[model samples]
Target: MGMSYRRYLYGERVYGCSKCKTHLATIHSMISRAFNGQHGRAYLFESVVNIVEGEPCDRPMTTGNHTVRDIYCIKCNTTLGWKYDKAYEVSQRYKEGKFILERNLLVDVQ
Candidate 1:
């Protein structure tokens, strides 16, 4: 395995992995906070960093069926949330290529 390097984010409000404090996303990138996850509330982000994406698989969600991959914190390898690879619903197409991070798994690092 190659050596892994994590990126540090600088923003007015930064969100990170609660377990390891590794930067994930910033407030500027957040699209919505009205989402829900397995653990509870989740936030949708336009982009994210310092994480690893697992294999994509089909999953049925409240909105619709989607192909998603579980995302893990690079520093601690904790399951933070998932990334949308393909959205099956036309109305949910906007979520493709985006990421979701569980609120309970995040910590404000600003």
Candidate 2:
């Protein structure tokens, strides 16, 4: 394997992994706040960094079934959330290629 480089995000509001405080995403990249995760409330993000994704698997969610891959913090290996690969419901298709970061597992690093 090659060396892995972590990206740092600079902005007014930065969300990071609670365990390692690694930069994940900024407020400007946030898509929505009314989402739920395994831990509790979550936020949907247009993009995120400094994380690794696991294999994609089909999971049923409140909106519908989706093919998602669990995302983990690259610095601390903490499971932060998941990334939507495919949405089964047309109404939920907007979430595909987006990411979810649990509020309970995040910290305001900025």
Candidate 3:
């Protein structure tokens, strides 16, 4: 079954990652998707819990759909997420200035 984002949004707490347990983003900050990002799929997220490290580079991302910097877990070097240094879509513009984490990608501990 798919994860219930709504529960995490209303529930007391949430956590991240099965391997490292790094405190990632929250459900409250989640922005629902509308067809973009990886594989032309719609991606969603907002702020993170503990700050992570981003390795910015010139390489284009998601089929040059975005100018991106890869984010990693400071402690374990696991790829926590990324940020859009620049975006090609207006719908993506709001997130362009923010970090999009994969808390949902990880195992939610709440």
TM-score of each: 0.97, 0.98, 0.62
Q: Considering every candidate listed, which one attains the maximal TM-score?
A: 2
What tens digits encode model 3's per-residue C-alpha lDDT throughout 1-110? 65423212224556565476655656676676543543344345666555455666554544446777876665566765676677776665675756655534466665
TM-score of 2: 0.98
lDDT string, candidate 1, 4-103, tens digits: 9988999799999999899999999999999999999999999999999999999999998999999999888999999999999999999999999999
Give the poorly placed runs of model 3, Cα more than 4 Å off: 1-13, 33-43, 58-64, 103-105
Candidate 2 per-residue C-alpha lDDT over 49-73 given as tens digits, one digit per residue, 9 for 90 to 100: 9999999999998898999999999
lDDT of each: 0.96, 0.96, 0.57
Candidate 3 residue 3 C-alpha distance from true site, Å: 34
Off by over 4 Å in 1: none
Instruction: Estimate the overall C-alpha local distance difference test score of candidate 1.
Output: 0.96
Alpha carbon deviation, residue 16, candidate 1 (Å): 0.6
Q: Which regions in candidate 2 have their CA more than 4 angstroms from the true location?
A: none
Q: Once model 2 is optimally superposed onto the true structure by TM-score, how far is the C-alpha of residue 54 displaced, in angstroms?
A: 0.3
